[model samples]
Target chain A: MQTKETIVCRCEDITLEEIKSLIDQGYRTIDEIKRVIRAGMGPCQGRTCRMLIAQELAKYYGIPVGEVLMPTFRPTVRPVKLGTFAGGE
Target chain B: MPKVKETEILIVGGGPAGLSAASAAANLGASVLVLERDEKPGGQLIKQTHKFFGSKKQYAGDRGYQIGDLLIEQCGNNPKVEVWTNTTALGIYEDGVVTAEGRAKHLKINPKKIIVATGASEKMITFPNNDLPGIYGAGAVQTLMNVHGIVPGRRVLMIGAGNIGLIVSYQLMQAGVEIAAIIEAAPTIGGYLVHASKIRRAGVPILTSHTITEAYGNESVEGAIICKLDEGWQPVSGSEQDLKVDVICLAVGLSPLTELCFQADCQMKYVSELSGHVPVRNEHLETTRPGLYVAGDVSGVEEASSAMVEGRLAGISAACSLGYGEDIAPKLQAEALAELSELRAGPAGQKTLRGIMNLMDKGGAVC
Candidate 1:
């Protein structure tokens, strides 16, 4: 496993220090932390950062990792062209 | 006599838009009920493991799942809003009634106004072995890896370069899976340049003007045969490339779930730009069918951020139609229009705008 020092949340390029600050700010939930710091809204989505955030939130809240909720996946899971959708017509 | 489960408004879909709609209406002092098919709210945002772009007010730079949580908290903490999870809205009746099924029990309820945030369904492309066991939608892969903690495959061949395709390829890498390649029939990468740049930097080959013609596995996808396309999309001669991969992820596109709107007999039009046939909705997000409203992908295929704005508009629009704070609807409508316009600004938004224009032209209505 990569060390905890690796920058996971790329959108904000959030480091461990900033995430710790969010936890100190009473943002225990991943969602709350994200809203406060813009941690996960980059183009890569949360692919690289979600698990790490979950871990940090758990450590901060003193909760088990399983208690944390994951994000919902929607369709078009890849970027699709609108033109292709209408081509059938 | 039967407990009188009633609210001034009902919002279906439980996605970002649905949650926002409930929050928007409740904040306006209106009683609201939100129905979600999933065990929890947040819709696709829950599975989105990506960061978002936009302004701070929109939670730009937040992961999709985090946004889902914030919205859920905002909606859940409000006394005026009641959210039902694992509740499937079976159908939308003409008289502003919603039929839902939960725990194998069916129930019917009526609200003064309705907002259809039912979202859209994943589309599929027909190929010789598309129905094979290993073939799945890109969204499904996300659910498995990001949500369920199970990798979709050891090696994957992605078809499509739109945002979904590109993003998933990167995600598969994050999950420690190898991406053989991403194939798109278009001459250029379809999704955002930043997204493409990420995977490209990671050494994943994005083959444009190429497509997977067939999957060659008896019952599971073992490998795929890809080919380059001419201007007419016909496979050019001798352009075949074969890939060895366990999973084939289709990130083709989504089709709006406008059937409920159509069933209500709202003014419907086949707008190719809108992801499929959609209901003709006005500035207030109200469908032509007076009390009926459509939000999120069902209105048109847009992101969760836009869905939130549209959801707020739809909820406010519905609340106004129900005779609750009717005067405030116009102001809310204007704000939503402005927000949506801003969200649609940028290079990637050009195609979306084009799609919306096509939809508007087909409906012969002003956007």
Candidate 2:
């Protein structure tokens, strides 16, 4: 049982119960989970929360931690302020 | 107008490694520029206050932050070097092109040589209530106290007995924070005995072969459950104990932040001894890509001393690649590699040495 108010993503304040509910509802992978509920898309860019979700999925599938497929590695790994990109071409 | 920035050498990150790279390349007459994401250019060095080990050239036995200042000044003093703070190097692309984002604008950069000195990130261990707000990575805790002067909490439970964990535990004590205990999964302490002894004398108990089973808290960390583990790393049933702690600091480990290297098409190897997936580089720290180099924790997780040496090797090699430093590259590389071997000597560095050997596909000749 997960609490709806239990926060997972601190920047966006997404909750564990929300993530578990998503996983239980067939959003098993991180990609599907991210599309449904934005957990790792915050300022941290999943620095704090990404591996937790992957470990959870690995446990659920009875697979090793290395077997879990991670999300795509994108640039701008560190969060840039919105104004940083709002400039001329 | 957005003008394209040009330089002979582009070094990403300005920590001990990148700064060393800059100083080396600049000394060799290569136009050098460093892109640092932090507001200040010390990287993790700003958070360190303890004396370091290794050679005198690296300023061994001085406080870490002071060394950071020394390196910063050295880089700043170089006529050919320029450092941009608060600038994030996004990634490397074809034809020596890289993108960077500053405070209010994005810029395109083209350089003849590139060094990836992006360093490493703290790794978190899994446990119940691990998502609690009061739980912090070791680096985060250090930055809070050393940089922002904010004490994390009154009492803390440190998980992991590696160098970072041991050093931070002592630093927390210096900051007037109480350490509840240190729980490590390994049978023996993972860091040096010197560091462990300092904290042990401070009346902190380091429980070996133990793991944090759960953390108890409502909204913030209020307590933790630690259990002794068998050789298999499975927790023993009757060994669990709940301890009172306001903060849980995970010093479990660090992993090299090699995603940029991956994006640049550098070959990588998963070596746990090196702290996760690291790029496969040659003796000169040149990765699979020509004119592309790596230094410090981005190449592998190690201390700043060796990182600085590796940075020098990479810098000299990059300089040579661009038709500079021809006279000094050979001697500089040999001396740096020698310094690295001396630092990595003894039982402590055996695993890392092995990992480096495996990655290089050679024996200890590189040392």
Candidate 3:
């Protein structure tokens, strides 16, 4: 049996083991995982890890992927620096 | 506060569509300006090494990057067309005002017309352990190997049989990476048979009706488990097959990035055939809101060939509306539409036709 040490969320460096452990602890939805471990809340802004986490939760619950609640996406869609707004950058 | 800029025609995105629009509009004697978010102007066109497939007018034999450069060169040569690299159009505000962040200065542009040509983003697939570091979207991998000139991994497991997956698989192989397998949930390969054959001749097995069940590794992607799917697309429990791989490339599809269009108050509708919600535009590529237009993937998830055609249509329409090139506008738009219709007449284009028809039937094409 392979232990989960592979990284799922690279930005925050969250591991597969950590995610599975969180799931085992009964965090069912993606929102719950984001709440517990911050997998999707990162600099890349979940563009990389969002679908992965959503599908993982869907698979773990043996549900359709479309059924998984996606985290709400906000705009500033492309990264805009706060400093750019303040004339600092 | 940044200085406000004014132009006759303002185009967002500097890829094939935007550049084509700039060239067309500027050639018609309208002052055109293009704002691209990237440091360079090619968009994803820079990351493509393969020659595109279309008629000679669309550069059927030339490489994608070459065509991109050609578009830029011609557009750049137009005295009336100005391109600003590293410029991101933040939004198209009400009253036809636009705000953008430029490399050297922030810009508030008031243009006579606006065209949004922002392209699409890669779609992802779900599988157990998909979050592993080695997993990547086809676009990301293309950007890595094709754009940055770095091989992403030693071995790749390609998911989906679409053009991006097929093309990227070949591009990776050309770059000295081994492909373990290409698994598609569809019974038949999704892309052109020609592309599928090229990979097949290279000794890569095309596994149809199969899907990745999970990817497993401790530190990175070391292996993947694929399984055959039943009629309902559920994994057939006993058909699990594992393969050793370092990277998993998902080339499922692309969805149009219509955020700017939405911000501009363009009506959007969910059309699965077009790869998701796209801005509703009339025959001339004009959206419901006057003076605002859309082209490229932002209008609908179509090929670069069609994007260019649509761009020319919008460019000509906008230029004519502003009292430039009125005599030739109708002929030019008709030719663009004809070329687009022919390009979409292939076996691959039937679906696009259906998608467009579906949208039109649902009033998504109202303008």
Q: Can you write out model 2's per-residue Cα lDDT over B165-259, one digit (the tens) per residue?
A: 99999999999999999989999999999999999998999999999877777778889889999999898999889999999999988878887
Error of 1 at B107 (Å): 0.5
The digit string of per-residue lDDT tens for model 1 on B188-294 reads 98798899999999999999989887787765778988999998988998988889889999898877776567667777765556666678776677777777788
DockQ per candidate: 0.01, 0.30, 0.18
Question: Worst ten-residue run, lDDT, model 1 chain A?
Answer: A72-81
iRMS (Å) per candidate: 19.3, 4.4, 4.6
lDDT of 3 at B363: 58
Candidate 2 lDDT, A1-89, residue by residue in tens: 24324456665667666777787787778877876777888877776667667767877788875467767766767676666666732
- Residues B77-166 of candidate 3 have per-residue lDDT tens digits of 899999999888877777888888887455789999998888887876545676778999988999999888999999999998988899
Best by lDDT: 2
For model 2, the docking class works out as acceptable
Index of the highest-TM-score prediction:
2
- Order of the predicted models by TM-score, top scorer first: 2, 3, 1
List the candidates ranked by DockQ, beginning with the highest: 2, 3, 1
